[model samples]
Target: MKHHYWEAPIVIYLFLGGLGGGIFFLASVFDLIVAPGAGPLFFAPVFFALAALALGCFFLVFELGQPPVFWRVFTTKTAIIKWGAVLLTVAMICGFVWWASYLPLLGWQWAAGLAGLLAPVRSLMIGLAGVAGFGIMVYTGVMLSTLKAHAFWATPALPVLFTVSALSTACAAIALSLGGAVDAAGLGLLVEELIREIVHEVDIVLVIAEIVVLLVMVLSFYGAGNVTAQKVAARWVRGRTAPLFWGGMVGGGLLLPLALYLAGAGTAASEVVAPILVLCGGLLLRYLCVYSDERAPIPGEERYYERLKSSDTRFMTAWKQGENKY
Candidate 1:
């Protein structure tokens, strides 16, 4: 059986982590900066970001084979593990502060007390979270790309693709949260138009950037001339993985959503649908990426197998000796 070490948990981690990081990231840079007095920043989007980040952290623990083993990430200087964790931890802390704005409504005096305690240093936390958020957004791709054995994932463009996708999904999540808050607040069309405009514009740019990175990753992987790289790229372009790769990711995720955003041209429903499609595409892309990886062939392995399959007694003797079975 083939050894595919990455499981569903890793996929989930990448999706949620990227998404959560992106929400916190965009919230710090875009929404918070632009909507200073807007309660939606505190009451909804930040809560959603925290929730997504927390869940992604859970998945990360799950993938560790044992939850307690998570500490090993910190105990050692494993760059990916240590840094990805720091991103999640810092983002969660900031998210909690922002999300805590709802606590008083729930009659939680403890949270109100905590909120007061946090007020003085809140801006610093948000800033730290944004830096961490940027790390969370890109680290998953970096983690995968560092696996030099997987020619499919070992590209610089993988991180770029993931970063763009992360930002795109984050924008979609924020738009949804803000939309709900707007309806609840009974805001007028003017507010709705502004939010929609922001979402539509940002999503289109992020989606376009993601598509470009994806194209570059795939083309470069195939064009590199490594037989293993060809096989990996073939999974997307010419092999069994094509349907989901092209259909789900390209069609449903990117192209269709892009078309919807452009065609709807400001319809609220289209704006909503556009993000959902992009979010779904991001998910499907992650799944395809984890599942389609074929580890690079071992050096001299193809030749060894070729000779072993031949009716060459000398090759058989050498193979048996190498296996210490002679």
Candidate 2:
């Protein structure tokens, strides 16, 4: 039985969400390791990170056809979805409380101050949230890998690929946000300095690794000759999705971003153009992956399936018809 192709927006969301969650996790780790008591600066990213994570989950829900039954996943006591739901809820509450305490309200200020006293507790919670977020980030990729239908996504490296892409995109998002604050000179400097000192160098290495993994994955598919995998590969090479797969995902997402970082663009740029490009590239990669995956033909049956008009619809109709006939 065939399935509808995963849509572009869903793919983009998956990529961005995973990347965002993973980055948030990484940031929490950083806060624990480097800036032990840095107050708002440390907590602000965590807040944004959790918020982004929740937003990503919303996208995933929409992508999954908005089934009424979907909520059942949340109710299952032993399900991973339940764990993810609980973790996300805790993260949101902790993040909001941590962030709200900084707002300049009269009585609220005092309340915030009182909440601030719980920083140590919040820190621990954020750390655990990071672990949960990381699981969610990697789970999406693992989910895909489990689909024996798409041999292209079956590799062990796919999960790691997703994780790396998530980190790269997350950093891109943070960089873009920080860059937007360029007019606030002091804040801009702090943002830039933090990115330069903490994110830039490490990201360069991460991007390199992402590129390597992508290359290896594609090559492995080429070597395998499985029709489904080849079809997915074609999307990256010469199909309608090729431009995004090659240009945006590879060139813009990995290569150009890395080049800019290595060229010292992070500290030197007055405008946010470079970081924005990276973010766009990351988003494009996600979009491309989803599009490609949806269109990917089943292995060993490409010719028979390729002749069918409206592959997705035809496939699904055939599936339903077969089920009814059976």
Candidate 3:
């Protein structure tokens, strides 16, 4: 069986982390700047962001196998994973608190006191979470790019691609959940519609940016990168991963969604169908990138591994101890 260094868990963790970070960042923009008096309108998105971050962290720890070993990440200051862990923790804590600040709106008497206590510093907490969330979105791609051995991943475009995709997906998520979460009056309903419209427009731009960055990254490697990178890029361009890359990501993920958003604008096709496709594309991007880890092997390494694979399995078991038990 062929072994993969990073598996589904890592892909999931990266996707969820970027998504959560984007949601938090956008929520902060809406609450603190876009509509300060309408902070409660974003309560649902913030909650979803917190949940995503928490689940992403859980997957990260679970991927470590021995979960206790996850603590070792904080013991090192220079490691990229260490910084990611810190950012994730900070984003989660602050996001949770910010989300909690609106609990009284649910008519939960038990949460009224907690909500009141957090009301004073709610904006501050949100600001902190937004910063940390942005960091997490960038960190996901930066972490992959830092692995210099993997020629396909050590590129500048990856970070930009991931960030843009994160924001786009987050915008979609917010648009999907924004209406249901709000309990506003006549004017408030108008503001909600305006926010949804803004989100749709912003997502269209983000999707375009993601397409540009993704193509630049892949085509650059395919055209002029080293042998290892070229091989990986080939897989994405016209080889095994081509269908998913072109069909799932480019066609369905980017172009179709863009078309839907443009045609319907803020209608169900744009708000519902397009956003769902964007999210799926975002997840597929992570899956493809994580699996495209191609390490440039030293001389003779490839042949050596091939020889090992072809070697007779019985040869190893054929040997016995000095007792001649064979």
Candidate 4:
């Protein structure tokens, strides 16, 4: 009956938040900068980004135990969770509006009318959403790093790692959906090829950056960290968590994708297989970080908790409210 403060819901929430945020940010770059007049090509990714943000919010609220009062997050101005709520809300709203601005290109007459009305503020919404999206990507890591009790999470390198990973995965997601969206928009093969080349090239750099950062974080902890951090680093290095960290994350996630991008370049291996692996690695990164909640226990704490009956039994079931017979 091992228990931790954060669990699966939090993990999913973190992963989805970064992913959704990254997608929105990259979508903005593609639409407004990289390929202007190509807004129609981004409809699918924007839709998926909005969905991911909504789903992540749902999971966050579900994990709170008291869903009815989730709005209380806005009441506290100083709470980190409050900042996250605000960023997520702003990103989703602006992102949806930005996405809607291109509906006319999809042959929706009703949407065309609505989009015309939205034209004036379209660029503003996209810019705002991009700012908020970047905020969410950084916030996920900062939230964890701020938890000082967890030796493994409280590090400057974490936010950097998460941000790089977020952008990398976002590129992968965009690559996966680019072809279909291009066909839908009739944007032509030239545009699609240009966008695909840009995304794949960017992803290669990101994967390399992630590998370096991850190695530095682990090796630093193993070398100079405190007792708990060293223990967790050991688990990731030569201990039980080694296989997944080295083989799955380092090999399959980073190096293999790099090789695929360089060698396979334009083939399905680079476009499809590599991106999927990058996504899996992104998810695995969050899963590992969330589970690395091993705190440095105080003296006598372990023995005291081990001897407590409440640790093994449900305290509420020990007695009924009015059934005391003593």
Top lDDT: which candidate number? 3
Backbone clashes, each candidate: 0, 2, 0, 0
The global Cα lDDT (0 to 1) of model 1 is 0.77
Q: Over the full model, what C-alpha lDDT does candidate 4 score relative to the true structure?
A: 0.87
Per-residue lDDT for 1-326 in model 2, tens only? 23556765567557656755765576566656655443345344555675676676677677676655666667777655566556556555655654454443223555666666665476675676567667767776676776656666677878888777777666665554433312334764565466546666666677888899888887677666477777677657787667777777788767776776877553544125555666676666556554545335446565676666555775577677876432
Task: Count clashing residue pairs in model 2.
Answer: 2
Clash number for candidate 4: 0
Q: How close is candidate 4 to the true structure, as a TM-score?
A: 0.92
* lDDT tens digits, residue span 46-126, model 4: 888899899999999999979999998999789888899999999999998887877866667889888988877877887
Candidates in order have lDDT scores of 0.77, 0.62, 0.88, 0.87
Q: With candidate 1 superimposed using the best TM-score fit, by how many Å does residue 102's alpha carbon deviate from the native?
A: 4.8
| Model 1 C-alpha lDDT per residue in residues 67-96, reported as the tens digit of each score | 876777776576777888877887898767
Q: In candidate 4, which residue pairs clash?
A: none
Score residue 22 of candidate 2 by CA lDDT: 66
TM-score to native of every candidate shown: 0.84, 0.77, 0.93, 0.92
Clashing pairs in 1: none
Off by over 4 Å in 2: 66-70, 77-87, 104-114, 178-195, 266-271, 294-326
- Cα lDDT, model 3, residue 78: 88
What lDDT score is found at residue 148 in candidate 1?
A: 76
